[model samples]
Target: MARPGVPAPPPEPPRVGITLQQLRQSQGLSLDELSRKAGVSKSMLSQIERNQANPTVAVVWRLATALGVGVGELLGDGRPAPPAIVTVPAHGTPTLKSPDGKCELRILGPIDLAGEFEWYELTVQPGGALESEAHEPGSREHLSVLAGTLEVSAGSDTSRLKAGETARYAVDLPHAIRNTGKTIASALLVVLHAA
Candidate 1:
């Protein structure tokens, strides 16, 4: 089975059809609804959920974002979380880049806190910005600037924070963080979810 100068194909990702279908149903989302939310075609989603097709990474990411779950969760065994202190090394943390690719958010929270709360180490390149949609009602976000300056806008209000400064605001409405400074900006963001 060895081919000269040829690499073996990568193994397939875990089948996620059943898990995707179950999650959609549990969330009371119809194929059309999920399609609209995830920006994927209904036919493609149907195919993926039926295991008829292996989705691309972009598709999986869109679906995961719509489902409010991580890609790992989508591909993982659905198991109840066990009580334990989780440690994530900097290099091992998952990072998501903004659509523009100018900002990066490193997930710094444990998996168990996924939907309820999250912590992120956010890095914004000069003139970069991270915009977010509205979260669940009563959700709040706290940001502590570690370097440079940041401009934060929540709903109709906007504020600026410099290094060593902190800002807390309601995130139930649209929010954004922009690095208006010439240098790169880094910050720690903590999101507290509503019960």
Candidate 2:
């Protein structure tokens, strides 16, 4: 709150559309090309560029992946240098949830390294599962249980894990981390993509 006679802070400028357009133009990419690469419709891209549409988080993630840039870079000025020490507030971290709403994943890795390597703090309610399809060939994941008990399945193999236990498994095939315990479960999950 501002004191009497004190001015309030200025509002932040809208930058998403501008930044998207600039990145597209700077990369010499046409609307059709970007749409194809980002797996977004050209019409939607045009709307986004014209500030007529506000994209969802999934759309932004796809755009960032196609541009080979971080989500922050797409949302802010390009690739700003980090300070000696950087702190991202807990609330500022991005999160993804399962469609069933029983599992939540807090993204913990820098977006720039998303495809190569990524980490997440995962929480699953009792009887919930974090299931995933095959990843890129040779991709692997490591899960270190932090609370409660969980079960991990990679292809045909499965193992139960308790707090303080870790499991490393290939994720190129179908995989899942299920919380079959009576309480919530937490784990640190790290994924390493193929070369």
Best by TM-score: 2
Best model per lDDT: 2
Question: lDDT of model 2 at residue 156?
Answer: 98
Deviation in Å, model 1, residue 42 alpha carbon: 61
CA lDDT of each prediction against the hidden true structure:
0.90, 0.91
Q: Could you tell me which residue pairs clash in candidate 2? A: none
Model 2 C-alpha lDDT per residue in residues 38-63, reported as the tens digit of each score:
99999999998888887888999999
Number of colliding residue pairs in each model: 0, 0
Candidate 2: residue 90 Cα off by (Å) = 0.9
Q: Which stretches of candidate 1 lie over 4 Å from their true place?
A: 1-86
Per-candidate TM vs. native? 0.56, 0.59
List, residue by residue over 1-195, the lDDT tens digit for candidate 1: 759899888877777788888888867899999999999999999998898987888998999999888898777664312324445577899999998898999999887999799999999999999999999999999999999999999999999999999999999999999999999999999999999
TM-score between candidate 1 and the true structure: 0.56
CA lDDT, candidate 1, residue 194: 94
